[model samples]
Target: MTPTGDELLAMLSALANPLRLRIVAQLAGGRDYVSHLAREIGISRPLLHMHLQRLEAAGLIVGSLELSDDGKAMKYYEVVDFDLHLTASALAEAVRTLPPTDQEKP
Candidate 1:
């Protein structure tokens, strides 16, 4: 499904980070667990989790829980199938649809 204006902005914001971009690149190969991703990406689990949450919220990635061999629960994440053709006009239109920021608040 095509993302709504706010949804597109959220997805764009989620991908704006370098670390999150790397996470996307890694997950592009295959689904992976948080610990493994943190190790591979050279970051802490907490940090990875923060980025993962954002990606999941933006619908850029999907996460599922699984029981490992030793009966341990693991959460794995993978990129979702989302196609976005971000042209200048598309971005401008999307940006125009966003609600005013807190700075605009009285």
Candidate 2:
């Protein structure tokens, strides 16, 4: 399937941040619960949640809520298989097709 301009923008935006990149790298190793992920990445849970939301929205990650043995719902995050092989020409073409962002508006 062809990717939408918005999808490409969102994925790029999500990966642009250092924290989010680390989150992606950590999730790459294995599926992880939020608490453990935050601790391992040296970030707070809320902050981690924000980054996870962006990644999830961008289709770079997937999250599922499951009931644990204690009957508590735990959210687990895993990396999605999105091998983006972007070349300079492809990126330029994509950018050429992008509608003007807010900053470009008068």
Candidate with the greatest lDDT versus the true structure: 1
**Residues 1-106, candidate 2, lDDT per residue (tens digit)?**
3355677789999999999999999999999999999999999999999999999999999999999999999999999998786777667766776888899989
Query: For model 1, how does the per-residue alpha-carbon lDDT over 57-83 read when each residue is reduced to its tens digit?
Result: 999999999999999999999999889
Q: Stretches of candidate 1 above 4 Å error?
A: 92-106
lDDT of 1: 0.92
lDDT of each: 0.92, 0.90
Error of 1 at 34 (Å): 0.8
TM-score of 2: 0.84
Say what the RMSD of model 1 is.
2.8
What is the TM-score of candidate 1?
0.84
Stretches of model 2 off by over 4 angstroms after superposition: 100-106
